[model samples]
Target: MSKISTLQVEKVNTHIVNWLITYAENAKVNGFVVGISGGVDSAVTSTLCAQTGLSTLCVEMPIHQAPSHVSRGREHIEQLKKRFPNVTNVEADLTTIFDGFKTIVPIVSDSDKVNLSLANTRARLRMATLYYFAGIHGLLVAGTGNKVEDFGVGFYTKYGDGGVDLSPIADLMKSDVYALGKYLQIPNSILEASPTDGLFGDDRTDEDQLGASYDELEWAMLEEEKGKISENFSGREKTVFDIYKKLNTINQHKMNEIPVCIVSNDIK
Candidate 1:
């Protein structure tokens, strides 16, 4: 993939910041509240929110989170506070809350299903925490999803990380997010860290679960948009295209709006 130039980066930065300011002003909200995940996406998003010079709250809700994730999240928050006076941070440790939830929930025989459900629960807990802060402070919850995850593969948990008042960077690809992160001078620790949801309480990466990397998925998405099929490629390319197609097919529920049964006037 081609790298984004410096001029493009500067333009995008200014554009997103101005857009955020306009949205907040029109919505009659004070500012934005973003979840800091010690990853490039959240770091870039929080930085953009801070640039608006509005109240930006960086909340860290860790539930059995990795130590490295905690350290990197705190590092970025401290750096953001120093750079923008409008930036503030809070840590809501949800470890005990998670444990309590597990104890109360009934046990299941399928361990894999149980584990997946619990991982999603972690994301939902964080989403609720962010909304609580947003409600008390009159701020909008800013989402940190990129295009590849949000639309291409439907990688995020529905109503979990997907639950948000507004999405700031959902249109940008993963590579574009990193380019913007570099332009914003985000902490290197976060920039270099592997992308993970950190919901499973382990060191598994996004690739480990997705069976393909972001770059590969991005390419597959573009190819599919151009009406290409898996037969058009061979070797690892074929494998990646198949993987992307399977995920995109199965995750349509997350990507589409909730189904609502409409009744005719006669029936009513």
Candidate 2:
């Protein structure tokens, strides 16, 4: 049972497709760029952008620790080309650059922060690569984040995957993201693959981090979006909302286009 009303889903999905065309034209870019991670979000974004009739550059950026993930990303790219021949793939090993940074920055033993930092670094590096190509070739970077992954949990890194000229899936729930994939006629092979960041291979999953399934995420989001929490909420619902609020503040920093400065007019 989806919290998103049928009318609401239809309206939002329509807006998503329309925005793809509008953003591409308004940005004066003939195409879009996406770092496909073999994840549902990226695959959906690439297909949607292509469906809008814009050429999309799908990048496969994998750290050396997980080169196999790049192969998965490549498979998705091949899938993208079969549907939209305008899609192109780029293979970039982010480990080299991260290793370079490791030299300058003291090595840390904490896997939590280290993995988080490395994951974010990979995201930012992918964006940097995407924009470099877009800038030289005249294209827009199509961000691959959904409402469930981004707005609800703040799963994306600021200025990394979260930063983009347009967010085609920003308002969508993850369940609906899958639903939209079906609506868009995406291939089953690409859709059936596990959703992963490929940051660490210890079976680390998105739901493991969030402690909620995509269906549960949609249920909570609908409750919050519609202000149904006043009716009643489970213990887990409260936790989800608390996490949502915390991320709201964190991504607030991500959403800001410029930093606020306390200036005494500087050296004047």
Clashes of each: 0, 0
Task: Estimate the overall C-alpha local distance difference test score of candidate 1.
Answer: 0.93
Model 2 lDDT tens row, 167-212: 8888777777887777766666656766666665456677777666
Per-residue CA lDDT of model 1 for 1-268, tens digit only, reads 2334333788899999999999999999999999999999999999999999999999999998899999999999999999999999999999999999999998899999999999999999899999999999999999999998999999999989999988899988888898899999999998888899999999999999999888889889889999999999999989999999999999999999999999999989
RMSD of 2: 3.4
lDDT of each: 0.93, 0.72
What TM-score, computed on C-alpha atoms, does each candidate reach? 0.97, 0.83
| RMSD in Å for model 1 | 1.4
Error of 2 at 111 (Å): 4.1
Off by over 4 Å in 1: 1-7
Residue 171 in model 1: lDDT: 86
Model 1, residue pairs in steric clash: none
Off by over 4 Å in 2: 1-15, 65-68, 109-111, 228-231, 238-251, 255-268
